[model samples]
Target: MKTPSDSQNNWDSLREKIIGLGDHSLRKTYYPELQQKLDDLQQSEERFRATFNQAAVGIALAGLDGRWLQINRKLCDTVGYTEEELKNLTFQDITHPDDLKVSLEWFHRVLAGEIRNYSIEKRYIHKNGSTVWINLTVSLVSESSGNHKYLIAVIEDITERKRTEEALRDAYNELDKRVAERTAELVKTITALQEEVADRITAEQALQAEMRERMRTMEELRRKDQMLMQQSRQAAMGEMIGNIAHQWRQPLNTIGLYIQGLLVPGECGEFSKEHLEAGVNKAMQVIFHMSQTIDDFRNFFRPDKEMTLFRVDEVVAKTVSLVEGSYRCQQIKVEVKTKGEPLINGYPNEYSQVLLNILINARDAFLEKKIADARVELRVFTEKGKAVVTITDNAGGIPAGILDRIFDPYFTTKGPDKGTGVGLYMSKTIIEKNMNGRLTARNTGNGAEFRIEV
Candidate 1:
């Protein structure tokens, strides 16, 4: 390269020769203007050289075949290579192997007149055998005749920016993994809780079904007990009818005998006023006694409508009176021994029925065993704040096998035709269930004893 001052000396020698060939007047006229134009061109070339060498980013020029013709100072520092060293190698030799194919395609497109310039991010191999990330922009330059001359490439280092973006991506992936694990745990816990709730609901349903079945069974038993009570009442009514017949038999015969004797007196011609008056008086007395007997049986059979206060001893005595006639015919004696006038609150008629049942059962035992002197003794007293009545018989006591079951419904030792088993069962029900009392039976030395307490 020639210095500008040397070029000026050469231009002076060439001007002397041209002045010798041309007119002396023409050289005198154009010499000053020519010198001014040469000075201006030199200044322009110096400005371009200063800007290219001092630029902050890397700048380079390469031939169409990728041979580096020139490299700036910044480009030498960026790739850790001197300008002379880069000149010996093509741009393809410094480019990373992974990025070479795409870079060559862009260069070809420019050569084919498809684009004016292209910019891409790519990796370059540094002189120290390390990778350098960079943003590269390349433009095509042509000669004055419009033929391709060389390429001008500008590059910026972007290694730090790329490293920061990679770090952010890794952090986002870790956070997403933690969130997924927590969500799975919550779903599993919720499923377990739902299953436990279902089990509890099933248990409650089973318990409710069992309770309903028990209530239905209790209702059925209640209806059966009521039916048994009605049967016992009917059986007792039949026994009362028999007693009434026994009581009226002797009175009816006496009245018949009196009326017949009066007829005989008329037939013998001795029908006097005094004799007729005496017969009428005797017949009226018998008829009055018979009427009283009917009233006792009628009252005994009437059901009690409500609770009332009554003495246990008085109820026992009245009950014995109702059955006395029948017992007399059967030759069974009843003795009542009362210690106190113990009062209790209950259905009075039902109490009498209970006593009548025990008395009748005693009579049956006596007849069944054929005891010579059958006797039933009842005692009424107050024991431990309760009214109590006990009836004992001397008919060889109830058998050991059947004593415990005597009060059970439909349990009887008598033949079916002679006995309906509901009598004692209903009697126990009246004392215990209806009156809130207790009825118990046990074998005694002479016979069986039944005790009632309220």
Candidate 2:
């Protein structure tokens, strides 16, 4: 074996001889391949430079100490600073004071290898003394030995987008305010409409009430007109009766005088006592009949008068006296019983009319029944602090079915010509409404009883 240095030299010489043999052939073949690889590397470098320089987002390489080691043109333009000026300052110099701590904390995290990348939107001061809002993305780059070497930061301007967002929010708020205002206006309008509807309903109700009142008034007027017509007929009948009674008055008086003259004694001035008494009694009967006829006429045409306190017995007596002649002819007995002389306050004429109406009804009842021994009883008394007068007749009783409506206007059991049907109704009105008294009627066992309480 040769020495180690001679062996290494022999190997080097072999390598040189091999290299020398291929110098021209290698130049012709491997030189083109080497040139192509170099061109590919240059092209890749150009593509990287073009991509970095033309990016819209600003890119920067910063040292671990936060100094700008390199910056793209976009970053220089975004911060309004030259590359040389930016390299002289640290990232903390341009960061807002309020954002600086948070940004440094994040940077420290990246340096510690705790986070791969971080992003934040923060405000920064530009070279021209204006504020810029930007979104920043930071990534940590380490050496192959795992030492924290540099940080890559991507910055994007977001001031216009933030302002636009704020403007949109303001517009939405304005629209909401306008909608609320319109809703309030609509609510007020609805309230007004409801009020108007209520007012219209009230007015309609009032109108209906007024119309009802007018109808009631018209019906009352019609009733009054009918009453006037009935009264006219009654007046005419009363006038004819008055004339007939007037015509009989003188002849009846003359007959009474003649009879009385006959009762006087001749020459001796004292005749047989029985004969004189008989003649005098006959004369008395004539005078009584004449007197009753005159009273009937008087009562029939009696005028209305103001209210006054009067004895009930007196009113009853007057009513009975007015119809006595007619009753005497019919053989109807009249019985009167009173509890002292009870006084009542009322319109005397109207009260008299009420009594007269009841008496006439009793008379008609007796005639209709045709009872041989018909009788009418008039009783006056006080009950429950009220003056009461009861008129009862022994005759055919009223039918039970028609009794309830007997007091209604235009209701009567008698024939139309014999009874106007208004007598009881008018009597009820006078006693109840005019005199503030009560009048009622009910059928008894044999006949009917009419009661007046004042």
Candidate 3:
């Protein structure tokens, strides 16, 4: 119905309208979908950024040349450095010198793809001039085109763990040192104690040897004393009549004096009771003194058959008293001193013989010296739980040449009638072999002293 130009215009306008409508409809539908996709992508990107920045482990990207390309907040905080500062520094610059070679070797392995990921526990220099220990994990990153881009590293701070390890090591070392010192001290103390024990044992051995030697000497003296005692008994028996006559002369003279006094009673026809009593008493005293002399001679040679605890001081005192009258007849003075209770276990008769022997020897020594001031002193004392009896004569000291022979049988320093030489030998035998004691004689300044320890 229209001409050609009109038809062309209408077709063009229709086609343009259709095209506009189609464009409008497509824009209206596809715009929202595209926008949604864009928003999702943006959210994903934000999430990734936040996760990277807030990661607890340090994250970093570095080149094969050890240049740092990117560093996260955690990396900066771990090294005590700003992100900008870390970016400017190479990983090698912060790496400990000692660990540098090892770290490079690990990096080289990662780049060669010999390992998927590499990890190392290493030390790093911090910005504050301190050191940080880290567990480092490194991985190589590559693009789709197979081009190696950078090295990704994750570093976890292990300073606290390292410090704890060091503390334990130090404590162990300290304890070892203390143990060594204690061991040394204990060894020294044990050694000292052992030495002391050894010394004591040696000393005891020496003392025992000395005691054995003394016992041997005492036995030898006992044999000699027995022989001398036998000889002295024979000699005394032959001279008994002379000794009796010598001892009875004074007592007989006293009895004669007492009888004369009784004959002249004072003013009473009957005999005076006082005079009679005095005369009887005087005669009894003389008889008793004579009887004691005979008893001494008899007991000195008597063999004892029993052991008893006898008071040593009392025995010595009795022997001295018995010999007092004889010593007074010779004008010799005797002295005695007793201390504590000198109780000793022995045969009383044998001990009495020992005392008598010593007293006779002392009296003879005094008579031989005949020094104007003749004194014999007998002292008894207790020392360290043992009784010590000492007989000292103020007569001339014994001659050194004869001192050792004094206890030998038949070895006399005086005339046969005056000295039998058996007295000291017998005394030593009784005091030691019989009594389980010690006897020693030494010359003093004035004369000789004999000490008996029981």
Candidate 4:
């Protein structure tokens, strides 16, 4: 063994001889220069051996057959062996079983010239029977002729590094599990929310459909009510015209007889002023009454534009006169009594029509029942600042069964050809709904009494 001092002195001598050749190499003599170059090569080999013995990393030289030919102090320390003990052992003797196959594969590839060097992490068994992890790098050392030779392997202990990698792997696996669990919970919550939204949409659609159906039903009812009202008014007009014709019959006949009587006095030359005046006066009186009847009908039949102040008694009196001639023809007596002229703000024509409807119903009752000496009494008075009118007939009251429903639309006691059934119904509607008054009927000893309060 050469001491480190002998190697150091040889390297110093080579440096001094190379400096003597100095600036340019071609200026040096040949044989002496060759001798200096050989000396420098020898010194480099000595320095390499010194570094290999003292290196901290393990270094070893092995045969291509996996036998250890040379090993440094660090390699012996890493394997828990002295140089003499490791010298007899092949690398395979201490390599762990699991790492042996891969380690051999790399060695063979290096020998075959397929690879120049290789690095791997492998396990080796120390002499003390403990395991050691190491990073091993094998470099191929071939002959100048490219023939396969020994291999040089450099190794570093890495037990702590391998343990750290195992702990990190466990932590990554746990994190992955927690992420999967959270994702599953989110998916479940989203599904529930979607179902709730779908149910609410269905309910809203059902509600909208129901509302549309109700609107259609209401429109149909309104149209029916309108048609019925127009028909009722037409029926009342026909009845009023018939009464007018009845009133005109006697007056027209009397006027013709008076004209004949005047012709006799004129043609006989018996032109007396008294006879001419009396005959002319009687004819004029009949004409005046007929004109007055037409005027009254005109006022009562005209539609009112808006509410106005009018006397209830006067309205009642005019309404009675309209049917006065008809009542006498049927042998029915009508008496009208009033206390004071009660003024009210309302539709007077419509109010008269309501009274007409009631009186006509009474007259019809008398005719249908063939009641003799039938009479209808009308009373107009004021009660508590409100106008009141009542019409009582002696033609017998309505039957108990349908009396309560008289004011209902399309309810009637008369036959279909005789009445439209909406007469009394429309009367009640005009008084109560249109005029903001009350019209009610109740049975009395004499007949049915209809009361109007405004």
lDDT of 1 by residue, 126-159 (tens): 9999999899999988766878878899988887
Query: Quick one: best lDDT, which candidate?
Result: 1
Model 3, 259-371: lDDT tens digits are 78787776457676776897899889988987888886676557777888889888888667666766777777888898888888888766766666666777777777777
> Positional deviation of 85 in candidate 1, in angstroms?
33
Total clashing pairs in model 2: 0
Q: After superposition, how far is residue 105 of candidate 2 from its true place, in Å?
A: 33
Name model 2 segments beyond 4 Å from true. Answer: 1-202, 205-209, 212-216, 219-305
TM-score of each: 0.57, 0.52, 0.52, 0.54
What's every prediction's RMSD, in angstroms? 9.7, 20.1, 13.8, 9.3
**Better candidate number, 2 or 4, judged by TM-score:** 4
On TM-score, the leading prediction is 1
Better of 3 and 4 by lDDT: 4
For model 4, the local distance difference test gives 0.86
Q: How far does residue 149 in candidate 3 sit from its true spot (Å)?
A: 3.6
If the candidates were sorted by their lDDT against the true structure, best first, what order would they fall in?
1, 4, 2, 3
Write one digit per residue (lDDT tens) for candidate 4, span 53-142. 999999987877787777899888898989888878899899999899998898788877788999999999999998889999999877
| lDDT for residue 301 in candidate 3, whole number 0-100 | 55
Q: Which ten residues in a row have the lowest lDDT in candidate 4?
A: 22-31
1 or 3, greater by TM-score: 1
Return whichever of 2 and 4 wins on lDDT: 4
